[model samples]
Target: MNISRRALCGAAVLAATDLLSFHVLATPSAPKIRVGILKFGTVNWELDTIKHHKFDLANGIDVEIVYFAGEDASNVAMLAGDLDIIVSDWLWVSRQRSQGADLTLAPYSTAVGAIMVKDDASIRAIPDLAGKKIGVTGGSLDKSWLLIQGLARRDHKMDLTRESEIVFGAPPLLSEKAVSGELDAVLNFWHFCARLEANGFRRLVGADDAAKALGASGPVSALGYVFHDKWANENPNVTMGFLQASGAAKKLLAQSDAEWQRLAPIVRAEGRELEVLRDRYRQGIPDRPIAEEEKDAAKLYAILAELGGEKLVGGAPQMAPGTFWALKT
Candidate 1:
């Protein structure tokens, strides 16, 4: 039987539609990765500005940035399967790993912390802090704790836990307490440290000074960009894409101040002064992958091990294979 021209055209259209539908059904949708980050801090800068910009819409991968009040909250979320990755401190990762939670390092974000004191305070050095009330935010394996411990070891060889009167409080409250002279000193991240300095607080010692005192040649750094080992292994392409995007964002930030201006509000909220925020950015922000990051990670692991906190992985996790990612040549 001969077909009519109209019927032939209709049949062809139907066949085309069927083929398109089949293709659509056979192809998998892009995966969306949930990323938890600390709210409004250096890590926030890396996440909202760099990591968000990097992985949000590249290679069919979506990176959802979830802001948590602190590292403990972030860890809880990750453990609950709400987050595929966590860009946070290494100490937290070590603790989690010790608890049998599988996590791996992805990248190093920055290296900066300060020993802040009220401008009118008599305390000027580590030794002067004896019998003084220093504030620290506890839980989630705080880097500030490690900083204080390192300082105590170098200055007094006394245990921070037993020798110093360390008061535990939230980050904002700690900064406020230090400013009001309710607390003698605070070991705070850069953002808060900047605010304290702007409000007439003195930065008695900074990361650079600490590194110098410890006879370290490079920046006394902290780790960033952690990922769930299972999620990373299952989605290698997506994970690598996220890393690539983060590296790109870091490169962009390093190349321009305009990027920083655009991201300032996201970073410096919570009553933090803009000038102080800008100064903090200038003091020390790592914009690229550094070899020392691995060494920093190792040092952090050592500290935790000494504290009976967690055991360090001898080498980088198999998923990442290296401490940080490099662009494929």
Candidate 2:
């Protein structure tokens, strides 16, 4: 999941030609933007396209993409001024904001996490998870905490810290551990979860199921586009243009199966069918901007604060007023 910034930038240059054809050449007349993304999995359809310079050609803006191995690396790159934009989880953004990292939400990207058990495990529900060893990566930006929070809200305050033994490891290793029964449950993002179930592991809970259990309508955070505040301030026009182009891509992703198929191979090079990822994408992922992105971001901040992560700005991370970019009506 961790990638070098230099390698990602190289990938972006190659992707630009494949994605934008004639447009990338025209975009150099304008200022270029450099973006960083965390390489989390194989089916990074959105980020893959953006990283490859496909978006630059399509939007006529020269974009440079850098890949980090993990969100923490991407954050470090952003803090060190190596990247202008970062596409990461809301938790990373919230944690960064708490520590005084000036960043802005661009748009929501994904909406679900998968909770899986081994194929032979008798666990059928969240409550059945009592005393089981669960594997999750532990850190300030721990995504498992979000899943635990959702589970607690749904299953009558199940204390994850006490009820389940948590084993910390990187995501791929965690998935491997879960499959081998070294861990009873593992919480993961899209493709890993899908692969677990496809390989016969039982799904105890997913983002959508947890949302329904909590009587909520969506996942814990609206995953989406993010940018550094300083970068946006310095390159307002280019940033706005990037947002517009990203918004267009989001819309295009919704309307065109052909677009998905074309991009899927770039994302899943091992001949993984687009339909596998497409099903998960359609379930709860939001392609357009949402009024609740900031609200959900605030909620995530609150959860992190409760879990003793870090303090937000003004002692409480209030959603910055007018954070989202609205396309002209």
Candidate 3:
């Protein structure tokens, strides 16, 4: 992470490429690492930075980005061999691994939701949410809300579904409703949470806090770079080099405010919203060692499994082994 700027920024920035630009930076003979990503994914910021610095070529690989309009399509492309890598949660990776697919994950983000609300003395904690209307997305599939339920059950002896009104809607709509005072509290995606924070809504309890309270040793990375273990074993240099490139890009993004300037148009936010978004993204970067992540993930998986049953964790009693992929040192 402390790699020198001289090393990463030596190459002239290349023009942005939507589909494939491996040839732009790498020699024709270099290895091509095909990546599937959502068309509007935040992952593009890092990929753009990687291209700007020519990190992939410098690290001995070429990156070909294949954009999909939906996450499901991106995931399908990975399994169908149309992609070498895709961004997804480790739980999905675990499910695949259990079903005899050798998928693995490299930690990407721990960003989740929070109970956001206006300053009101009556709403101090989970108990205070009793009889209050809570706006949430993903209905029963909202992991942050599920974790909050686990936290409330463990700490406050309350069932959020029974005590509070759970209003399920799309994130933007739920956020809009929360602002109008119709919803007492809202739990939405992290970016929406950042916008809400910028607009003066405070965090009551974040998913990370709930995770910690539920026995996770550290923050759990809910999303990661997923790929097949077999392919990585066959292509060690590309695998390790890409991971290094990713780390370098994250380092640049974390330290350089100037870097965010070029990123602003893609971020499409102005003023406080932009600042808050940047800060929140910085907070979500994965810093823990893989052992800690795996340990914490196993713990959280059990919690989710107990609360959500087979639907949440598939049929596996424990997180399938090799859920977290580490570059062999």
Candidate 4:
């Protein structure tokens, strides 16, 4: 071919490539999605993986991670149109819906707290928690605490909130108290529970156990990517792509030990602590179909609301319809 013809052909090929690739937008900016995450949250691991593996780019999106110090801050950002997504529990989502918010949840992790005890502690069952100092993480409104209360009431006909001396504090602070032998048992978040377990602390009860006892078919997902349903509906492709990237990241983390090694500092563990963290995180990945997940979530919500009153579920007597966002097939 002539030089002019060859140049024209190359230009055509480049144009075609740009058109075929969503990452290479016609505009100057990348297709970006802003996500609000808790500072030092477990969600960071998956977000980091998405960046490391270029999953976002592959899915035709770029993730801009916005960090918040607390769940309330994240929710505020999401509500103010400052963020496209945020990590929160579906129960919270249900509460928001009841309050006139259009939020919905996409599954992230089923990981929740457990009642952890130090080695050689005499506490063995629900009845044993009576009259003992229990460090409860995230205050009295915590789902794990409420579920444990349900477990105790059902299994032992006891009110743990009243029977036990409850000390509500942050997870790290509570974990520290439990370690220093100040608290008899600690009901803490999953990562803290895993760390305690790996460090020889025993699990007296898991949130999953509490959930099952309350009539859930199995483990219920506790945290997920929550966003406004209207926004998600308007940007279906971007929303689906971002969720797909998240799933890809989870699948990578689940299968690759090397990925765990890379995320060591993120999880802040070493030796056996790291191993337990890995196992628990893997165990928490939501494997049930969306319908089944919603069914279990609905069941657990009713049970918790009945057991915990309006505190656990707020004004929402039932899980709002369409609380779980199903990925478009």
Which parts of model 2 have CA positions greater than 4 angstroms off? Answer: 1-27, 39-44, 47-54, 98-100, 138-141, 208-222, 255-266, 269-274, 287-289, 309-329
Instruction: State which candidate, 1 or 3, has the greater TM-score.
Output: 3
lDDT of each: 0.59, 0.58, 0.81, 0.81
Per-residue lDDT tens digits for candidate 2, residues 1-329, read: 43332332223211222323335434447567777765644325655555454664565566666767776787777778877776665555655565577765655455566678877789887777779998765432455456455557556668766788877777779889887778989887666676676666767776556544434445544454677766666665676556555544544455567767788546552334355565655553452225454555555455445555343233544444434433221
TM-score per candidate, in order? 0.70, 0.74, 0.89, 0.89
Instruction: Please list the Cα RMSD from the true structure of every candidate, rounded to 1 decimal place.
Output: 13.4, 7.7, 6.0, 9.5
Error of 4 at 224 (Å): 1.1
lDDT of 2: 0.58
Give the C-alpha miss distance for residue 249 in model 4, angstroms. 0.7
Instruction: Using lDDT as the measure, name the better of candidate 2 and candidate 3.
Output: 3
Clashes of 1: 0
| Candidate 3 C-alpha lDDT tens digits along 1-329 | 23221232221111122223343445779898998888877889889888787878867888888889988898888888789999998778998999999899878778888999986536888899999999987678667888999999988899999999999998889999988999999998888899999997889999999999889888778888889988987786788778767876777777778888888888777788888888998888777766687889999888888888888878997999888875442
Instruction: Summarize candidate 4's per-residue lDDT along 1-329 as a digit string, tens digits.
Output: 22232232222211222212334222335578999998899999989988877777877788999889888888888889899999898889998888888899877788989999977989888799889999998887777888888888888999988898999998899999999999999999999999999987989998899898888887678987889888877777788678767777777777888889999988888789999999999999877666677789898888778876787777888999878874332
| Collision pairs in model 2 | 1-69, 2-69, 3-68, 3-69, 15-52, 16-52, 16-53, 109-223, 109-224
lDDT of 4 at 119: 79
Given candidate 4, what's the lDDT at residue 178? 92
